[model samples]
Target: MQKKNNYHFETRAIHEGETGDGWSGATLPPIFQSAAHYHESAESLSKTFAGETQDHIYMRLSNPTNRFLEQKLAALESGAGAVATGSGMAAINNACMTLLRSGDEFVASRSLFMSSYTLFTTIFKKYGIRVRLVDPLNLDDIEQAINEKTRFVYMETITNPGMEIADIKQIAQISHTKGIPLMIDNTLASPWLCRPIELGADIVLHSTTKYLSGHGGALGGVVVDAGNFDWTRERFSDFAPFVEQRGRLAFLHRLFKEIHVNFGTTPAPLHSYLTAIGLNTLGLRMERHMENAIRVADFLKDQPKVEWVNFPGFEDHGCHEMAKTQFCNKGFGAMLTFGLKDQAACFKFIDHLDMILNIANLGDCKTLIIHPYSSQYISFSPALKNKLADPQLLRFSLGVEHAEDICNDVAQALEAI
Candidate 1:
């Protein structure tokens, strides 16, 4: 309680993963880049492979650097343990593949990151798995989507681009009553803003490529297990061997052994190291990011050329109250969406920007702007694109830059349009 009231996010981000690498008194974990490990004896190596001991056998399995980041992430998210992966989508893929079967189904929020929507509709669909999309704001819609065969319920801490927030506590309750785990994609609401597990989510996933690696040079993802889900139900028959062996670690064990190793989505040690360095400043970055978002959102709303602005920080926003409570009233988030006249106006604004980069990425220390309707959601049907946001919507990822400078740039760009 003391730490939670203090700058716990900052304290935990820097201190939680410090187990002392032993050889060097270095402050941060050193990167374990080698692909192979030489054990003292054949029996020791054999024991590692047999799961009798916890040791790094190969880079494909684990690394000290990746484990360091995983530990820090687990601590920050209040999770039981964490597994790092090559990309955010890799984290989602591995976690879902671990829990789902061929004939199983799952319920998900209609407002999802573009790639996630594709993976659920296409890849999972190809495997004979079904995904039911529903409005996360409606408890009845979420409840109706879950049937007997539903394996889990998936949602985002905050919907990407859509700027929607779920009632996680109530949603978790609904999922629990049906004997299912609630998985949340917490990439946008990084632990500094919200820890989904503390709100009753059973699993949390992140794209460390974003806020966790604030500089945007690293690409990584992670899965944080709360280790509080009921995995012994008969419906989880496939988890029998894993449960019998690992008990509380059944999900982690199966994730590492069956899917992660064979799928080969291992994160590079350098990526983990870079993410760790960025994570140390996460609390700081998030504070400025949220502040700047509010300044920018307030500035954009009054612009004459701007058609509409959607930021949960605004009291009139549909999710404002929910976001307020979920984020502990700290701030809404660093992301917001505003619409222009049309696609042409969006392009004109982008061409006029001086400092902000026109990129397909978000959650950077450097502000980024993207037109999802034409870029990220380009391949989607017209109706689907509009469903997520207006055809002329511009998604802004506020950085730690001076709010005045950012507003000035935005003002000049709108004038150019």
Candidate 2:
């Protein structure tokens, strides 16, 4: 499919990157699963390896099926280019490694996904990269955290478990003032709900294992470059050569050539195919997800067993207005964290639920629930755990199931608790 600038999001979602098979006339892209492609001549193969021609050399570098998904994701996020990865953590690692050298630092929102927090504090720290965690809503704290070695600012569109929304545009302005890019993890607010690049993000990432796949089957991730950041500034002297060579494509060039390729974070072609199929129905699935979420939030709010709901769709949420403005009032996201009476009630409710799955993953077609304190945030220290998790809190990922049935299941589960 040829991407037309005038195409609406729904049309682009289904048609943007799909170039139908010329050989079989298949409307859907077929998975090119071969580990390597044969060239007609040794000269052509040499040219490809030498960067004089474009061709797949090995599965570790690229695949046709993954390329198709990358194009679609880049188009959907309004980015210039994308690199698909084996997992969301790989995308994060690739982005960080591409930008930050050893001993350099980056600022990130404290309310990050558990694995991300672990990656920054443990893995990246072990490699000598320093990470400063700040409150996304506090501009003063973010400003204070930045230093001469700061490479970029990172935050999620909507935080995990906490459900807080960051002001991307404001943070981008702050980051740009210091000659640093703004990298956003847009997993929760998938491209269907928010395009962070359009909101001034220089780099956007997603764990396609979640909503983009719409099923909990495939594990994949992607980093999309907006192609807008100026990498020629004095603060980023390291990127000068890439900027001179690739111009607006400098970030993608560095990411693909340095971090992604070297680390071998390439995703499987079969997983990419499954993700593409899921994205075709993203607009439809997100609509149902939002609808079901609102209904579920309302039901939980009225229940006497529920202590409080932290969904942004609720008017009382601190970032509710910001979410509406940023998401264009389409819908607040489907993820929510609600508090019950205590840890026992939380576990009992989760265990008693009939319809909702008690799983660690989110963004499945069926409702999923998890207790973050014990599952996702188990490694956090007491102070860190208090900041990001609660013993009585339950994180819920609403699905496209009927609203009434979901509510009934929750009600029965609460009653049992």
Candidate 3:
């Protein structure tokens, strides 16, 4: 059956990646585990090497399993194409390296994932790429920060453990006005909750290792190009190489053929295989995650010992309204961060959790909790880290567990604190 563009997300999630092979007729996509494919003829090899034909020549450049995941994600995100990477940071790094040059600027939200902030401050800056941090909630701040050298505006759909929602459309509009593209990390707000591309973003990214996989077993990331931004636009001279060669698909085409392949950041076929299976149940899992999260947030908000809670679904949250406008009716997301009485209480709560896992990761089938100051933000300087990550903050990632049971576990943990 031919697929339609108007297909619902739930349907697309399962059907988009499956391509039945002529010989096997296998319902499941078999991992193309080999490292290389032999070219049938010199003409075919020339076509493939010259980009005249889109065939897998080397696993480092492309793999059938990775391509399936890429196709499915591209369809789900409403993107023109996608590139999968070995890890989430690789996706961000490659995107920056491909689009930015020395002295080029990119605006980003201040309260982003710690690793991203570190990437901007330590890594990207080392290459002379400048990162300008701004308040994500302020449109004026975004406008003021952008200048002629600006290449893109980047932010998370929902700020990491902070759980603050961003006005994606507003930001995208601001970026477009300046001939800059808006790039969003939609890891926390997977397409099931919010489709960033449809909200006016040019590039949507993900750490598929998280919720998309629903399991902590694999590590992978993807960058999906919305095909909205015109690379031919004169401001992006960095894109000249691709346009001079590959035309419209300049950015993604070069990214896949050069930066991704040459840098050796390709996603493994095995990881793609597992992520594909995980995506099959994303809709069902996200629903349960939303349900459990809301219940947990509501329960946390009422506790006398808790100092503050930040969940976009909460009326008291800074971006509750923005979240309501941007996300599907399923509530903000499955993630939230709350403050306890103090640092001591935070550790006590985390250490006492019975059912929830205390690992540093989020977006899992089993509930996960962590003290950001120690786990996720450990690499930063003490004073600066405190500014970025509150010492008393506890980040919670709701899972597909029973709400009541999850609530009870949180309650018991709080009581112990």
Better-scoring candidate (TM-score), 2 or 3: 2
After superposing candidate 1, which stretches have Cα over 4 Å from the reference?
1-7
Best by lDDT: 1
Q: Judge candidate 3 against the unseen true structure and give its global Cα lDDT, from 0 to 1.
A: 0.87
Candidate 1 per-residue lDDT, tens place, 1-417, comes to 123425567877876776544537887788877998889999999999987887889999988889889988998899989999999999999999998889999999999999999999998999999999999899999999999899999999889888999999999999999999999999998999999999999989999999999999999999999989878987787899998998877887788889999999999999999999999899999999999999999999999999999999998999999999988999999999998999999999999999999998999999999998889888888887777656688999999999999999999998987
Model 3 bad stretches (over 4 Å): none
Worst 10 residues of 1 by lDDT: 1-10
Candidate ranking (lDDT, best to worst): 1, 2, 3
Enumerate residue pairs that collide in model 1.
none
Tell me how far the alpha carbon of residue 329 in candidate 3 is from the true structure, in angstroms, after superposition.
2.3
- Compared with the true structure, model 1 gives a TM-score of 0.97
Residue 166 alpha-carbon offset, candidate 2, angstroms: 0.8
Clashes of 3: 0
Give the per-residue lDDT digits (tens) of candidate 2, residues 1-417: 456689778778888886745428776778898999888999998988877876878888888889989999999999999999999989998998999889999999998999999888888898899999999999989988999999999999999887889999989998888789999999998999999999899999999999999988899999999999998888888888899878988989999999888989999899999999999889999999999999999999999989999899999889999989999999999999899999999989988988899998988899999999988888778898877789989999999999999999999998998
CA lDDT of each prediction against the hidden true structure: 0.91, 0.91, 0.87
